[model samples]
Target: MPLTGRNFLYLLIASGIYFLSARFAVLLFSLEPGNIALIWLPSGIGLLMVLRFGYWAVPFIVVASYLANSAGMAAVLSELAWLHTSTAALSNGLESALAATLMRRLLPEGLQSFQDIFPFVFGVCLVSTAVNSTILVVNLVMAGFFAVESSWMIWLILIVTNSLGILLLIPLAQAVLQAWESRLQMRLGDAARCIALFIICTGMTWLAFDMFAGFIFLIMPALMFLAVQGRKESVYVTLTVTVGLTVALAAENYGPFQLQTDEWSRLYLLSYLYSLIVLVLGTELYQRDLLSEVQARQSWQYRAHHDALTSLGNRSLFIPLLENEMKRAERMNRAFALALIDLDNFKSFNDSFGHALGDKVLKEFAQLVRKNLRDIDVAARMGGDEFAILFPETPMSEARHAVERLRKQVEKLTIKYHGRTIQFTISSGLAEFIPHEKHTSDAILGRVDQLLYEAKRQGRNQVQA
Candidate 1:
């Protein structure tokens, strides 16, 4: 119950952050540190939102903004406060929600590290900004500022500038929150990168003359972080930059801080866009690197155990494990069987057709035997046209039954190579190894081989026990 409650609280916080962030972006363009001092507390709660929740979070955000604006409006003008507040919230909500939804669809497959940050930001944040900014423009027009013809210029400026503002804040927000929470696995190197990101964001916030220049310088450090750092660090870096920029602008009494409504809105959208791109790119790069490492290791491991052609476990890995199992079974006073299977008329088929057909026949025969075995059972190709199964806790009689089934399955299998179809059967030998038997692993394998020879001698396609 406690866990559930904590989770609920977390959801509220995250959703609130998402909502407020969108709302704030629409209203002020920039989330001035001063303006958001009280409101920004809700942002961190989003970590608890299930991935599915990022979709519905937009509307809640819009309402939060409306509430904030209403409170502001009431503090000053009491008349028509409700109407203005609702209009503000709805416009922001529609745009932000649409963007978040689009992002959810294009969301990367797995959440890795810094590499995925950029793409995620571009998809979720930039797109969201575009949507929300458009809605903001429409709302202004609806308020009788102008018709589409007169408002088109303002709309374009609002969309582009605000989107940049939102993009800028994303990294700063990510850095502060993610770092404080220790969400990213950061060693000395990651810490250095985060600090570097802070410096760059701060410099841009303090030194840059125009929005475009601010973004260009600010995003450079972010791109660097995304390309190299892991997920947590990348987000941390983005967040920190965003927060720093907002704080700086507010301190200077610029744009959102001074209630320069248009500039504030532009900055807000840009900040969100920055955050979205960084998040996506960081995630992609990190996951891609991890997947590559995994694949490399798996390939190395497979090469050790499996036949290159047939993908059946080869002699090196299979024989030793089988021997160990046999030893364990003997100590427990249990019985087990090793069955040796040899393809009959294999050489003849190869002579009549080709070595390609022979290889195909061997692979098909291995598959057939593998399909007949239990999941716990180990099947291996001892050599060309030769295979074996270690049947744990089985007696001689049961082993013989298994061998018969295998033979029948093999007989049913056919291989086609170069349009020539050839059928083949296998002869199997079932041999039991008991505790009292004076047999080494080699001796047991040799016994099965001898039985296999006997089966071949008796006839080409029968099981000999």
Candidate 2:
């Protein structure tokens, strides 16, 4: 890539971070003959850079790996350090590029489900890391760094460490990236829960490594709780801290695995940590998918039953609601009221002011209905300029009074559109259903329709019962 301003800045930052993480890993956990750490953090860093910036990041990875490896070997190998470090750098860069490409191909949707975990682990982690480790170990053997017979063991160690690096870091990195992209905000309770999980994991890590081996198992439950109840990013953060602490203490011979050889201990820990990562991430992703599905279903249902223009319950919803209220009134041996309302001269108003203003007027009237009605009352936009209201267990006198009040409110309702003032009014028909009276919902609706036309006939802007 050309050294444009943004590209140069990204390369500089990526190379610096990769170099620092490599040096840190070498200083803390370098193995014999190759300076290979049991947990090679730079591998993960390089892969993250490749995934973020594409293949443009490979040159920076190669440069950083060369510097880190040559710094460790220059004094001893002197002349040959250049050759060995060059090969190792190429391998590191190649590993990152290959892993990123494979991940994109295998998980086109990113890691958001249980099925994604398998492809990520097998395709990106094991396959790419194995190839890179083989290349590096072969170069070491050719340079006389280790015996030919020992190449297999060295390659095995490199695979385990490199795989562990990618497995541990990538999921956490993805979570951080997703959170950043979404501009996620945490509520007070959620923030508190995340902090509590972090504290619990930290304390548990100390006890497990420094005091009791059995305490390590308890950390899994803590992580599981965070995965299920806390945010995805928070869960990954707790996992990273817990794993980092466990590895650091174990390397210092402070943990239960100290009894085993260093290589075997690292391997065992890697296995446990890999399983932990999968289980926690899998649960979080599954829960997220289920939540998305539920939200989508609810949105569909709401759109299906509600009016698009006014957001009131449409005919599909109102008829069933009316029937249910009638059934309840009969069961309670009570009377209930229904009101059918029509806007006066709405067609002429629509022609005069345009459909846009007519829509605004309808929406405003729906809001008014919502504001004036009780919670138990039901309002629906039956069709254009026609609305229905259900007042359960209310007598005709009470219903008529409510309708009259609404009529007065409609007379005072004025809508201003584009500096043009528009005034409107409503005519309503009220019908009451008394218990022991044989009536179907359609019969009552027909009666209300006749009364509504009768009100319109007498004059507009009046209520007829």
Name the candidate that leads on lDDT.
Answer: 2
Model 1, span 70-187: residue lDDT tens: 6754554446657766876676556555544554566534334455455545665456556655665666565554467846655555555444434444444545465678755667
Worst 10 residues of 2 by lDDT: 27-36
Candidate 2 residue-wise lDDT, 1-465, digit = tens: 455789779878989999998887877665433445777878789888887777989989999999988876676664688989899999999999998899889986678777787898889888999999999888888777778986887788788778777876887888898889999899999999999989988898898877888888888888888887898889988887777677666666637665346556656776777777778878887887888889999999999999998889998999999999888898999899999999989898789878888888899889888888988899999998999999998999998898898889979987888988788999998899888788888999999999999999999899999
Candidates' C-alpha lDDT: 0.62, 0.84
Worst 10 residues of 1 by lDDT: 38-47
TM-score of each: 0.45, 0.91
